[model samples]
Target: MQLHELEVENYRAVRRARLSFGHTTVLIGENDSGKSSLLEALVRVLDGGAAEEPPNFESFQFHRDPVKHEIVGPIRIRIVFREREAGEWAGEVYAPIHDLLLRAGEDCREVAFELRAQPEGEVVWRLKSGKRKTSDPEVLRWLREFTPAIHLRAGMLTGYGTETLPCAPGLCRTGETELDEKIAAIEVAAERLISKTSPNQESDLEAGFKATRELLQLVTLPRDRKAPNLARRVREILGKGIDLNSSQPTLPGSNTSSEKLGILLLIAALLRVARGAMAKEMEPIWIIEDPEAHLHPKSLASISYFLSDIRWQKIITTYSGAMVGSMPLSNVRRLTRRRGVVTEHRVDVTQLSGVELRRIGYHLGAHRGAACFARMWLLVEGESEMWMLPQLARLCGYEFGVEGIECVEFAQSGLAPMIRVAEQLGIGWHVLADGDKAGQTYIDTIRRTVATKDRQGRFTLLNEPDIEHCFYKHGYAKVYQEHARLGGKSTRDMDPRRVIQRAVQTLSKPDLALRVIEAVAADGSPGVPDVLQKMIRTCVKVARSQSK
Candidate 1:
């Protein structure tokens, strides 16, 4: 089964939010923006391992608001799953799910697994016919069969400093009662022989056996040193004689990126094994949080591609721009937190077809990749502003990176579609353009097609022809003159735009702008052009205001 949508209410930072899922969804957000909480909620509801202990108040309920004195809620998380139909197991295995069908929609069958926790700490699953307490064995079995989710959280691959060697052949295998019985008998016989021959070693052998009362603990390190789950897991791998590091066969401590990636890959491999055995019967849902942890940018790109190739549905959470840029923007879900409420927004890049995405990919080069991390977007007309805006912002006492504002060069393309993309992504955006005929025409089109009122302001323009004129209008003509010979051209008589264009012919616009900014910086009394100053102040204001 595939998760079609998720509805979470009064769950941690998310007071109320509904998120839809695709084959692959990447959750992008700032720290503590409820991305982890969302994944945790899914795990608690769907992962059978967590069903043993129902969530408590601290885990389920939202914090009470002191000012509002809000009433405690019955924290609820509902996951809608699409039933499998194409595979062979769809009939025998998933047929029972059809009986519990919540609906038969046009595209696919959907069933909701609703988990609700009361204020008194009682949790229940609302099944199709009626509510079932989470303690019910039947409910837990259903969750395992239908919604077996694999959660790969941060640090999952690390921190194994001490681990015991695998047990000898045919010993301490997980879930093998017959093999375990034979091993126990052999151990007893061996212990008796050792005790009779070497009395001094008898006590140590007995102590070792007593310390590990459980069979699964046979291949694990000391109890105090290993995590409980890892302790139980070592025996399973031990039975298979799979030495992770075959060369020198040492228990890894997760020092290298390759080792970390190997751990993630191992998990995916196990899930794939499970998926294949089931005849792709039940869709294996993979939830990976911060897969970029311990991975360099190149590694993250490879992982992103690897994840995209997985057959089942995947949900990944990340804080890295490279991670976001590497994936299809259509799969990106941006999470934002304001005050105490958290929400999710996804840009409708899905509206673009495959060919369209390819076209956009060409446009989204290195400079545009920066937009993945931007809190607000500043769409400029050409390469000059994309290069010059940051420097100009510094000159105006603001920092672009520090403020999380990214300037995108649209190459004089229409702003209407780009504005829609920003709106769908919940990014605060403003357009900067010249007041010429073309810029005016685009701005007028934007005013009609784009939602400017929601943005607080429409396009801000320089009344002069372009930024070069704005520089001349300000007192920067002398600064530009100092950098370029300008053929003794003065802004008073010559066309300042032509002088600026010619200067760029010798030196790139950004290089020339840098030279002027450096000269003005040395001068220490550089005038902030009206247009540049307005843009910087506006960026700062918008960044601050929307960030709140």
Candidate 2:
């Protein structure tokens, strides 16, 4: 089962906040806008692994964290999620977080954690640091089993520890490889640069910076900060070039290809070993943070697909909304904090209207790019209807939040698939389809398709247009008759009105009144209220005339 949402308190930059999580949630904001802090909280909440007992913000990528700036004391992190059931949302699904971590700060009490789970649901939380007087066994079990663990931060670059190059002779320009004097010689050049230009102590500054620049050009990776792994690889390679005599592929270039290929092989081999090492019983919560550290967009795209293919649940956090946009919307939510409160702007990725869908495609360099895993589907009868619905929904305070909703031409596939997908992700699904001919057919289909005994059902199929029309959208004969008598612009759009009137003709006054109110509200205009006032008077007069 997938862990579906999160909440937090006093966690680094977030003094008090809550977040709505999707399966593949993209936490987007300006750097240090509490994005990484929330991620750290997730790590602590799910896996209970915070390095510093008191939670140091600087070490976890919060450059300007108030705490890191030494302004605040110890902090806390809380995460909450429900598990996914195979068929329905009956009561609650179970996905318990295991392991609890807390670091004592200079200012706060010993962090306390109490875990509670029931047939209803489970909740895990820790109090301000208190250094428990006595340990709770249930809490201990919760920490051991439920907490989700994240093994790697997305910034890795080397095969081994950063100090490997410096320690091994001939590994750089001079001589460092323990195996060969050639590696030891290569180490000399790297050491020369490290001594001259190292950002940190005992490292080559010029060599590291040059390697960083070269990697960025090669992979389009952001160079906000330098890393030791990429730097060491660069110096050793430039010092000795590719050892084609020993290398099998016979690379085409000496400038970067060989080194790049070598690093790729190292990472690939390591990943395989790592994947294999994972226990068959251990279902890890894989969080790949900004995976584009050393690959092209195309390659990154493939990597995303690979991650999606994994059988276990994975929550990938990315800076690129476009990448998330390519995934399912049922798994997306915007992370924003206001007044020190984190509010999740939860939106279905398929919330994009027809126009927004076209615009996104344009921005992505394809008129209709189908390559991305996530897509937004637009459901409408015709182009004219699709054009007007978004405007209407917006005027009524419904902004689909514009991420990845696709506009499809038909309702059968669009409606059913949309609801089914949302059910799987445990996201809300609302069906607002056209109220025209065969409209009832679509509604009935949705009802029967998703109608189950499960509590908290995900699909909501609204019969939105019923109260507005005088007749159902079908019944052409009645529509033409009403159109001729009313002298409308045309009778084509009037058939459904006739059908609705006939359907409710024998109903009581209260029933008719309820339908009338629905119609007026749906017209969605200030003038509509006035228009409804007149339509009621007309209906009353017509009823009296029929009585006479």
Candidate 3:
């Protein structure tokens, strides 16, 4: 089942927030923005292995608001699953929960569950339907097993070496008498082997036994590979096998044709978990944290595609623009935290209005992924500005990219629609527009219509005819002339400004921007123009503030 909505309150860093979920939700946020906390909260509420103990009073309680908040007893997390469509699990295993749903007046398809942390070091879990709530321990426990949720940590790959062997007889097999009988024999041998070799780590062996039992209860194991045999093989190979953790692959290495070791291992770990889930006929909800850990750009793309190929539902937390770029903007859920209270913001690009879609279609199509991942965005007037501003800012010693700021083009279609989207997505943004009459009119209209308080202060107008005109006025025409290779060019020409403007218009924005960068590198003479310098500084300040 897919999560339709999630509401979290009194949890770590989250005071109160209601969020919608997609089939594949990508959480993007800066450090300490509660992206990881959101994932942990999901695991805790769903009993998804991450919560070893219920949250305590000081650690997980949300006490940020002083005036309008009073209840501070339990940390609450609730999730509403979407009404089951065709193709969802409708087997006998789920029959008991169907009764609970019907008893609580819930539609047979939709289910809502809430989990709360008690002061007595235990969790209070309940199923809700309309005004009715059911706390039947057996039903709640069964639901937890029925809806399998697995969290794939960044360290899950290297940590697999510690995975203990299944110690219970027929732990991974169910409803197959013949296979179970064979597995029962193998289990005896495997347990004897583990007991001999890892006697000092008896808990690990016992935990493995418990894990096998739990797996058997949750999933219908296929007979292809019995758990006992797999466990025996793992134990036998423990010392004889090559330790995968000894020599991990790093980027810029000898093997350039394939993905790095870390990414490969990550993929393997995720696949192992997926295989186990699939064997049980369950569509698992996999929570992946920082899938880009130790991955190069190419590897990130490959791994992202590999993830999409899986049948399981995924909720990923990421800080990498490359990974975000590989997915649709609609899947992104931007998280933000202020004074220890977390909030979630999402805007589906496909759901935008027709007019807005037309206005920002080019913007979204080209830069949406980068913008979504950025801590702040600098929305500029056209492609030329977008291409030029970041390079220019770098020349002034204020690197936009280093500050997690992305430059995006509004393409002169205006900024109102794009600004609306930015606001909805909770992206901290600033605009750079021309000082020409049309640009001024557009900015003024946006300032009046866009109710966002900081929009006016954030906008940095060139105070000249346009960006190209500003370049000409700053004596950058000589550099442009040098790059464009204009025949019979003269800095003191009759109309060098017009000459440079015409040349910039003729060449591609990216090509011209590269020329400008080369020109700046070749000669540091005029340096950054004062007006552009001021704007870059302002943008850098805003970008840094948002990042912090």
Query: TM-score for all predictions?
Result: 0.74, 0.37, 0.70
Global lDDT scores for all candidate models: 0.60, 0.39, 0.60
Residues 62-135 of candidate 1: C-alpha lDDT, one tens digit per residue: 64554775744778888776644533224666554444543344455555667778767677765442232224
What lDDT does model 3 reach? 0.60
As for candidate 3, its clashing pairs are: none
Among all candidates shown, the one with the greatest TM-score: 1
- Cα deviation at 235, candidate 1, in Å, is 21
**Which stretches of candidate 3 lie above 4 Å from their native place?**
48-73, 86-93, 99-109, 120-122, 155-267, 271-281, 348-351, 354-368, 395-397, 412-414, 435-449, 452-455, 480-493, 501-527, 544-548
lDDT of 2: 0.39
Per-residue lDDT of candidate 3, residues 428-468 (tens digit): 77777788887787688677866777554578777787776
- lDDT string for model 2 (1-548, tens) is 34554555555566556666545555544344466667766665444333213222333332224434532323444444343433222222222221122332332221234322221222333432234322444443444343345434554222223332213222222122321232222234344432344254223323333343333233222431233333332322232332322323222232343333333322332232222222223345656566555545554554454455444555666666446656654455545454345555443436556554344334332322221222223344334333433433343434333323333334323455444443433233334344455666666766677646642222222344532342232222332243234434454455555544543454433454343334434544232332223322332333233212
Models ranked on TM-score? 1, 3, 2
Regions of model 1 farther than 4 Å from truth? 50-61, 66-71, 84-90, 102-106, 129-137, 155-282, 349-357, 365-367, 451-456, 486-492
Give the C-alpha miss distance for residue 310 in model 3, angstroms.
2.5
Candidate 1's error at 132, in angstroms? 13
